[model samples]
Every structure is written in C-alpha cells, then in structure tokens.
Target chain A: MRLMSKPHSARELTGLLKAPTGIVGFDDVTLGGLPAGRPTLICGAAGCGKTLFGITFLVNGATLCDEPGVFMTFEERPEDLEANFRSLGYDLNGLAAAGKLIVDHVRVERSEIEEAGEYDLEGLFVRLGFAVDRIGAKRVVLDTIESLFAGFTDQAILRAELRRLFGWLKERGLTAVITGERGEGQLTRHGLEEYVSDCVILLDNRVEDQIATRRLRVVKYRGSSHGTNEFPFLIDEDGISVLPITAPRRNLAVCNEIVSSGIPGLDAMIRNGGFYRGSTILVSGVSGTGKTTMASHFVNAACLRGERCTFFSFEESAEEICRNARSVGLDLHAHVAAGLLRFEWARPSLYGLEMHLARMQRDIETFKPAVVVIDAISAFRGPAGDVQSILLRTVDLLKSSGITAMFTSLRSGASRDEGTDHGLSSIMDSWIKLVDVEENGERNRILYLIKSRGTSHSNQLREFRMTDRGIELIDAYIGPEGVLTGTARITQEARDRAAADQRERESNRRQRQFARRREAVRRQIEELEAALQAEEDEEAMLLGEDELRDATLKSDQAARAIRRRAAE
Target chain B: MTSDAERLDEGAQEAGEDAGHYYLRLYVAGHTTKSTLALNNLKRVCETHLAGRYEIEVIDLRENPQLAAGDQILAIPTLVRRLPQPLKRIIGDLSNTEKVLVGLDIRPKVACP
Candidate 1:
C-alpha cells in the first residue's frame, strides 16, 4: 500500500519590537536578538553562574559590538568585580578606564536606614543617568536588586520603584540587565521583577554522581524568538561558554571506500576486500569470544599498510592490550614506536559527555588519523546517557572525516543470537559475530559475518583456532552426531568405537578356535583306529604289523601337532 | 542666631503644620539628567499650586552620600515625600507629570464661579 504525505502550511511571523541585546554568538539562538532598550531580569540561586552571565553579556557588548556598558553592582565592589573577571582574561577595569565601561556601586545598609511613609528612587536614576551619559552606555546591569528588600519593609514601594526603573530605562532606549535572587515558587525574590522586565533567564547548578554541571534556559523573552532548550554551560578561565546541544548541524558528504579487515581469509569473504572506509563496524560476541583479538588484528593490518591508527582502549590498558596481543603474534610495541599506532585509555566518567565528545573531536582533528578504534563500545554506553545518539553522532563525525571506525561490544550469553546492548546493529555497516562453541570435548571459537553493506562476505561460520602463530581457520566439521560440545563428546565417541572393535576381534577368535578343535578331533579318531590295528597285529606275530602302526603313529603325531596349534 | 536644636524643632513644627503641602526629598548621586529633570519638574509643580506651603529638598548623594540611609534610595532620581505619612516613592526623571503628580497626591486648586 502507498502512503500519503502531509502538506506544509505558512503562518504569519511577528518580529521583535524591543531593542536588541548586543550579545555576540547569543543571537544565533535568539533568532534576531533580545528585546532592545528594555530591562531583562536574570534570576537564579547564588553561585549558579548568574553573575558570570551578566558580566559576559556586558563584556561581549563592549568588545564585540562596540556598545558601551554600565555595571551597577549592589553586592560586590568594583575592585572585586574586576578581579573576578580578570581570571577569565577579560580586562573589565581596562574597559572602564578607557571610558567604554561604567561601574557603579549602591551601598545600602539596613542598620543605618529608617523607614518612612513615602520614598523615591531619584538618587538611583541620577547615578544611572550619569553613568549612561558619561560613556553613552547602551547596556546596564543591576546585579542582585534583591539587596534592597533587606533595607526596606514595604514591598508596594519597591514594586512601584522597579516598574518605574524599567520604564525609565526603556524611555532612554538603554538595554538593561537586572539580576535578583531566586525565590521558592517564584522567578525572583520580589516576584514582580519578572513581570516588569522584558526577558527572564534561569540558571541552575546541579551535581549528579559527584560531577557538577551548570545549565541555562531562557524562561521567557518578549518580542523575540529564542531557544527554549536547557543548554549546558561551562565556566572556565575563559569566562562562560554555552553549548547548544540541539543546534542545527551541517550535513557532510560520506565516502564509501572499501578497506581491508586487516585479517587474511576474512577479507576475501567480505566483497573481495573488506569494510568500506568511513563506515562503522560492530564486533559483537560473548566474553572470551575473540572480540579484542579481531580488533587488534584490524589495527595491526592498518599499521602494516602504513596508515596511522588510534585505539581508544576503555576496557583494557594500553600495556595490557599490547602484552596480550603478543600471544596472537601481534607486536604493537613496534608499531607504537614507529608512529603508526596510538593508544589512549580513559574512563568514561572522567568528565561530562559533551566534554568527552569535545575532547575526542579535538584529538581527531589534531591527529587526522586514517582509522579509529573504540575497543568495547559497551563501556561508553552507560556514562554517555543515551548510547544510541552518541554512537550515531560519533559514526557520522568519523564518516564525514573519511576515517574508518571500529567498535567492539560484549554480549551477555553463549548464544550467538544475542542482540547488542546499545542497539547499534541498525546503523552499523557491518556486524561480525564471534562465538565460542563446545565441539569434540574442546571449546572452539567460530567467526561469522552477519552483514556487510556494499560487499559480499562469507556466510558460513568456520572454526578458528588461536595458535602461537596467530588465528587459523579450519575446515567446517561434518559428522552424523552433529556438532560436538566440550571434550567429553570426543572422549565418549572414541570409547564407543573402541568397544565395537573389541567385540569383532573376540568373535573372530572363537571361529578360528572351533575350526582347529574340529581338525584335532578327526586326527584323534585316526590315531585311535591305528592304535587298535597295531595291537591286533602285535598279538598275531609280535612284529610285522609295523607299516600300519608307523603310519598311524605319524598321523597321530600330525594330529597332535594340529591339536596343539588349535589349543594355542 | 538660634541653637541647632531650636532651629530643627521650629522647622519640624512648620513642616507638621503644612498639611496640604507635599514635602519632597530627591536623593541623587550627582548632577545628572534624571536628577535635573526631577528637580525641575517638582519645582514647577510646587510653584504653580502649593507655592507658599510646599517644601522641596534636593539632596545630592555624592556630596552627602551617607544621607541616602535616611530614606532607602535604590536608584537615582528617586523622589520621596517625607511630610506625608506612609511615604511614597516615584522612580525616574518625572517625565510623566500627570502620573507623578497623581502618584504624589498633589492636586491643583480650582476657582469657584
């Protein structure tokens, strides 16, 4: 049956009406930009990196867009602020000295203040206006406005003042950043600041399994289109960097060049060559089924072809792998010394998944290797959250870079029909199954090619032995008792054949004994008759019955010899 | 000519007696556009209506910055009425005169026919 596809519909799009927030690289997610010349409140718990984000917005504006900024801090002094940003390689003090930045601190002490019936925010406006006019500051940050709540008891007055402050900023066409402490069930401590501002951002700091991760999400942005996903952010020596996990990716052309499997006789079954270059191959099997052996052989073959290869060893250390491969006639130490192979071992939980991916990308970009091997992909499945997505993206990345990718996965049981843990079979270009079958009282490893795209591979599962010289594929076993299992089968078969031969030998002996006994009986009868005749002759004349007697005696002697032979 | 205490008492009594007038204190960091505009607007309103009774104090926070504690001033160009009970605060340059006058509870006198 044929299926019908749906049609597309067009809708009217309303663009942003507020002043644009001159934040670099941030516009890529915010479509056009943030509301222009309007207050945007950024509220989060303390140490959630809210302050860093505020500083980043201002620094980015000053440096990238040539827009001057005004930072009005209520908690930290200007010196402390400058020192904090200095570690990020941002010269905030220099920018202030150069007249491109303005910093103002409003010191409010609750102990020194008296409550009155009516109040005004005229002093704050004057300071803000002075800073704005001094450098023509287009951006402003009022960090932790909640500090005012501690000095005042009247929420009504504070709310009115906040509304007016936002209105004033809008009137002056100056984009502003107002920061506040987050409150339970509310966006900010005052709860009215979010409504007064044009945009709101929430920053969260979470620790899962002793690993800290910071995330930022745009709660609301009026008159602007912004990404709503929670993007992971990092705070290092270089300030704040947000990684948009769901950003649109660029499509790259994939190459399909056939490459050898690095093992003789195995490549002949696979399309007269082997796996295509830039394709991902999954080597799945139970424990001790020669998965690592096959991967090592592939690496050795790649090295033999003078191609640079990288092996990411997660299950085994580099030295252990090298030492173990020695039994299989694979010497990796020489290849490593010759700069043909590199082995890197790291724990999957060493960092966040994105950080690990970024590190891998950096390494791949730097090395530009022709082949990459991730020994045992099962080790990376759990730590990376969703294994399928990570593997898919990794395959895409390697394929686009024209690098052959090989991964090994350990199955759970002895049955070769077991599926992979991460469900990578659907995407991998080739799936090789290795099994340990019990045959003839010995456990033998058998290798089978399940599928290989763009190539013809051997369909038969052949017996393979690990000898001192390396892996050797023996002829398939053909027997009436079917495939043998373990050494007991072979021992039992030998015992049954030996018993049958013994019974046949016993029957032949009985037949020969019967024939000899029958001949002996006939000879005995002749001797008896001769003896009787000799006796009669002796009685007649004591002498001359000799011929008959002699003949009978000779016959008796022959009979006696035959009887002895029969008895023996 | 008078002691400081006496002068303060006299000013307080006079401020107390003027119930119809709105006593306003503008806390500003320095001479800035918002501060100037707020001052000019308040002066114009007082002169036109409560010319004789109104008292407006312009306090520059930078000069006597410690005075900001007397009234909680979070932003500059903040206009506070101290004479009125349950003090009111209006933030901005007082550009919206109608809203600012209404917010300050100051109404112009109407002549009877």
Candidate 2:
C-alpha cells in the first residue's frame, strides 16, 4: 500500500470548478451553486430548513434544468414530504408519477435489529442506482444519514460502509445533496462525512431581538470562488433565496451635467455650476458639522428641482432628519410628502455589504432616483471590510445609473486632510471637507472645496454658519492672522478691534485737553488786555482830568502834582 | 453458541459495576506499536486499580488472526468494549479517552481510580 501511494500524481482538482445549480438567484451567493457529479453536505441544527433547502435543490433541478432527481428521506414519510411542499406550489406527486422525480424513505429502527454484523449496503446502492437510472437523475438528495448510525451499533463496520457508500456515489459521478444533523464540535454526528463530501454548506437559524432569521454560509466548497459571509436567506413559497452580500457592479462613466448642491453658495464654490449629475461626492467632517444637514440640503435641493432623491441615513431617524432640516432652514417635509424625496434609515449591519448594495440597487431601479445620499458611508465601513473597494463599487454603480451619490464620512481627531481615512479619499470625484477649527475660545465650522473633478473649485475654505435661514457659506474670512481657527478667532479679532478703538479714544482725549488749555490762556490774555485798556482809559481820563485840573491849577500853582506828572 | 457455565464465568468476571473500569481490547495486525502501546497502557491502567474490574484482551491477527472475524474488525487498533451491552468500538488507539468513555457509554468517575 505504501508503494502504491507514491503521492498519486494524478491530482484531483476539487475546488476550482463550480457546477451551476439551476436555481434562479441562488447562484449569486454560491457563485454558481454546488458542484455537478459530486456530493455536497448540508449540515445544520433542527428546524433550520435543511430539508426545505434540499427539496428546493431537487425541485429546481427537475423544473429549471429539465433534469430528473431522486430525494431519499430517512426521517419523513414520502407522503408527508409531498403534502408539505404542495403548499409551496410544488407538484412533487405529479413529478414522481411522471418519472421526473423519485423519492424514497429508508426506514431503519434500532429496536428491531439485534445483530451488529457486516452487511453489504448493496441493497441501498441498488435502489438508489435503479431510481437514478429510471429517472435519469442528474441531482439526488439524501436527507439525514445519521439514522443509519443509530440503527447499527458496530462503529467499526459502519465506518467502512459509510466510506464505501460515499466512494460509490462519487464513482458514479452523481451530483448529490446529503443533509446531516449538526453535532457539538463535529460537523455531523459521524464526522467522517465532511471529509468525503466535495462541498459543505451550513445553515443557521437564530433569533436575535425576537426576529428569527435563517442564514446560509458556505463552510467549504472544494472548487469554486464562493462567498464566505453568512448571508440571510429567505424560505418563502418560491423556495430558498440567499442575499449575496458583496459590491454591486461599478460603472466608470463620468457624468458631466451639473446639479445644485442645495446651497447656492456651495454650488458657486464648486465651480460656477455645481457637482456633476452622477459623480460621487464625499462630505467629511467632525461631529455636529452638519454632514447630515448637508445631505438633507442636497436631497431637498434635488427634490425642489423636481428630481427624485434617496437619503439612506445611518445615524438619524427619517423624522429627525426632516425636523432638523427645518431648523437649518431647509424644508424637507414638503419634498418627502410630495414623494420627491425618500428617506431610508438602516443600521449598517442590517445585512452584509453586498446585500445592502443589492437592496439599494433594487430600490434605485424601482424608484429611479436621480440622486442617492448615503448619510455617512463610514457607518457601513465596519461590515464592508475594505473601504476603497466598497466605495468604488458603490460609486461605480451609482454613476452607471446616472444617479448622483453623496457620502458623508466623519473624520476623527483634528485633521481635515482627505487622505486620513484609508483609501476612501481617492474614490471621490469631489471632496467637501468640513473642519471645526479652534481659535481663541470658540469652535467655528469651516467648509472647504477640497477637490472637484473636471471643474474649477474654490480653493478657499468658506465659513458656514447654520442658522434658521439654513446653512450660509459666508465669504472666506481673510483676517490679518490668516484663516481663523474655531470660534475663538472671531472673538479674538473682535477683542483686538475693541482695544484699538480704546487707544484712539485716549489720544483724542489728550488733544482735547491741550486745545482747551490754549483757548483758556488766550481768553485770559484778551480779558487782561481789555482790563489794561480800561485802566489806561481810566488813566487817560484821570490824566485828562488832571490836565484839566493842572491847566486850571497850572495857573493855580501847577497844582496837581500828578496831574503833577501829567502836568509836569 | 457457548455453554451456560462458560457464560456465567465470563459474566461474573466482567460484572464489576465500577463505571470507571473498562475492559478494552484493541484488535490489530502485527507488531505495530500503536496497537502495543494501546494494549500496554490499558494493561498498566488495569494493574493499577481496575486489576480486578478491568481486563484488556489484545488480539493480534498475525497470531490468532481468525479472532478478528469474531468482532468484525476493519481498522487497526480499534478499541472495543467487550463487557458493555451496546458494544462500542472506537477506531484509533485510546489516544483520546474522553471520546473513548463517551463513545463506550462509561460514566466517568469524578476522579480516576
């Protein structure tokens, strides 16, 4: 045996090629579901719809592929299986009667079998082989093989028999679905089955927050590029449908027609027109920087312009968005009521990224929105894995549909650079960076037109103030100290202006004091001169009088000696 | 197929209700030590405390080869519980006893004897 092994150079490729399971929409998740001519194991706990899933595979093969199938049930009676599927609109009885489907129930009871002896499974093989040949079955399902183990106690013989049975099935090149009951720490009760099967799919039924959900995941597929995420699958009347959680197809065609950004000033900043009609725009900023408000403004603007818009809000409720938009001076309620704007609030993990994209695609195709706004794409980054790939695919999908897409991402710390968050910066055709600059003591929001592809954009950071009138992008605040930081800059500038006014007032006060002193001195001089003139007049009068007296007394002895001086 | 007297002696020797002791036999072909270690370890364990309760019957197919047909053994070193009613057989050597006891339906003692 050792000499015969020789590493078996004839390699059997198990996992690269996928056989299309002719189930509509099922191939999207399994990536061309199940391998043909190989046995696949479907393992799950009780009531996880493992049987329903298996039956769907058979029914789908018979109806869609025009291929006959055989379903062997160890647990349920054949009549019971037929009746249960009838509600789902499957005509199993008709198919069986028409020789399109063959269903067999192998009854095994441990109480009746006393001998644990070796017996050829040739009877079972013969039955299965005959059924396959009779219906020309391309697909076969064996529901639950654990009953065989329960019926027989000889583990040594049973193990070899199981190996032989699997080998026999594979040798026949029959594509088969084998269901197994999940065991603790083991893929199945007899764990050897997983080793023999070409593919293994795990179905899970869980109740989270009272909402029961059935999820399907490909545990192992020997030869195909199968999606590895646990996808939510619905088992309705039509059978099982798995939601594929991956990026939708991206279309790279750039749209040139300009559209309003909702804010007239904002539109002016990003060229004289606005953002391209179908390009993706990133509006990133810190908390309370009006990212959602901006998204709402865009939605409202689009609606007012008579274009349909979808707002996928991750954080806020639709009611809150509408109510808050009014405070920002945007009335979105009218647009919502008018059916121009649709608000869809979703938790990022509502499904995997691919399922989210598919739902969005469905909505977009149905509503045909001209603009799609994912309130903040960052919320989706956790489950979406790689950020750049998701954003690129999303942008491509939107652009391909000619729908303008706007995504808001919240940046951590103080950096306003677009390059901060991984590779998301590269995928955006336009980047609107909102920064909360701290200058002096207050915080002020500043919006900058970072990059707008194919259009001239304002390089200056415009100060945007949110008020009752809405978001107003004030003229770029250019001060002596350059662009101010936060709200403190505005207060500091105000303080400086006040201090300069105080200095000018002090100088005027000194000049007034000097002029007042000079005027008072001149007045005193004039008064003194008047008084001197009056005194001189008086002296002249007295002199005149003395002269008159002297003249009278000059004869009278030159009298009046002052008169004497005057007379002298 | 066997006499009632022989069946009685076999039943009396095997009927120690001590759940911890297991009478195990690993059927294998030849001097493969995987089988020898399984036999030696089982005997060493029986000598320690289950000297009375446990018995290991190691069947070598190279010598008493037809004995393999009695148990219908396929894989080597297949540990078989001869005393237990729902006779349990585990295909490897008793490398993992937790699986062995669970497979053999032996209620494990809180502390090994």
Those runs of model 2 whose alpha carbons end farther than 4 Å from true positions after fitting are A1-38, A42-139, A156-175, A180-251, A303-310, A326-344, A349-370, A380-403, A413-419, A436-444, A465-470, A476-568, B1-113
Per-residue lDDT of candidate 2, residues A24-85 (tens digit): 45688777778777788989889988899888888878888787899988789889999999
Report the number of the highest-lDDT candidate: 2
Highest-scoring model, TM-score: 1
DockQ of each: 0.11, 0.02
lDDT (tens digit, per residue) of candidate 1 on A106-185: 77766444442244565676667777877989888888777877866667777677777777887897878788788888
lDDT against the true structure, each candidate = 0.72, 0.73
Please give the distance, in angstroms, between residue B43's alpha carbon in candidate 1 and its true position after superposition: 23
Q: What overall lDDT, based on C-alpha atoms, would model 2 receive against the true structure?
A: 0.73
Per residue, candidate 1 scores C-alpha lDDT tens digits across B1-113 of: 12533454456666673456566777766777667777887788778767887778888877765465446466566777655544567666677777566656665233223
